[model samples]
Target: MRESLKVQPHHLERDAYLYIRQSSMRQVVENVESTKRQYALRGRATALGWRDEQIIVVDNDQGESGASAAWREGFQRLVSDVGMGRAGIVMGLEVSRLARNNADWQRLLEICALADTLILDEDGVYDPTSFNDRLLLGLKGTMSEAELHVIKARLRGGILNKVRRGEYRCTLPTGLIYDQSGNVRLDPDTQVSETIAHFFDTFSRVGSACQTVKAFRKDGLLFPSRLRNSQTTVFRPLTASTANAS
Candidate 1:
């Protein structure tokens, strides 16, 4: 049997994972250029003699801030792959591709070291096994951390701009409507809406959801569905009978 190749030239076994991301709106909306840049990474993998099947390339089309590892699905999966021994080599444009946050970058580099994977950057190929490469990784991770700070400031400014427009920024409750003409109006033809109001009034009348349910039940009211959670999304309580009903 042929000798099993170690990370050195004698060893030829390598499974490559390519992580591709375009973090800004400018990068996302530019269909042609962004894709070509990403595909170039694939071409790079091919040049290294990695088969199409052996190379894993993942793409995310979101304005999602990569500064924090908490929000990136692709990054999380890549980390998991490295940890699980699936990825023998990890390739990306820069350390920022792994994380913008300092903590995530440190943790990922450590994991790659422990798992014995090769990390490739444009500057050089990093093997955590070597002390010099580890130092380089630490420096790159620090730079990524700084880049994240700038991205956060820009995002916070944009959110404040939205709030300044008097648009209710968060989730809206049922009775309110943001109409076609950009007006916040109350919905008029809501039957469940009226019933829901009555349920709330009953809650105020009885002082508890249980008492509301009991009193409504005493009045032969119908409930749509029962839920036990505090943040229950479904509510179907019967409304007061109209006096005009024959």
Candidate 2:
């Protein structure tokens, strides 16, 4: 089998770290091909002369965002291992999979450069120690970050445009909901509507959320709570926080 010249004997002697991540749980569930492609990098690592047992997969951050490394345990561990000379090369589907934040990406590159560790992606292997490779990697990181920013900006613009046209569909409060025509209206349920009206009236009289909750408890009244991902509403004992939120 042909091997990359960058994969030296010393590099093959060390473990290969395969870092896998997806931006969100929804993407993790729906973007199966991307995840598979990332896992398939193990084959690439083996082809490069690293043994299967020596390829370490750091996937704890699978459903976590790449925006920052502070909250990603897998990324933190990968960086720590690379810094400690435990990793010969770091493998990812791409630079964006590793990190979207330039600071985070740069930190990892610096650590890898210092440790003489190589980085591999679908494009090719990159040696952070080499000036050309490092420059290219830095550009990739910047573009990844810019891509995220552009996506957010586009989404924000679309939402703003919808709002300007009074067409933005947002979740309503407990006492209101979208009708069949997508217009916001008071809940049709008499009990729910009356209860919410009473809550507001009580709050106005009591002048405190805790007192309103106390009054509801005293009257043995239940507050309507909409269950997540379901159209059904449930009535339960009210708390000060819920009353205040309403």
Task: Score each candidate by Cα lDDT.
Answer: 0.67, 0.92
What is the Å distance of residue 212 in model 1 from its true position? 12
Top model number, lDDT = 2
- Residue pairs in clash, model 1: 5-11
What tens-digit string does per-residue lDDT give for candidate 2 at 11-130?
988999999999988899999999999999999998898999999999999889888999999999999999999999999999889999999999999999999999999999998989
User: 169 in model 1: Cα distance from truth in Å?
Assistant: 6.2
Report the Cα lDDT for candidate 1. Answer: 0.67
Taking all chains together, each candidate's TM-score versus the true structure is 0.59, 0.79
* lDDT for predicted candidate 2 compared with the true structure: 0.92
User: Residue 163 in candidate 1 has what lDDT?
Assistant: 85
**What local lDDT score does residue 171 receive in model 2, on the 0 to 100 scale?**
67
Q: Best by TM-score, which number?
A: 2
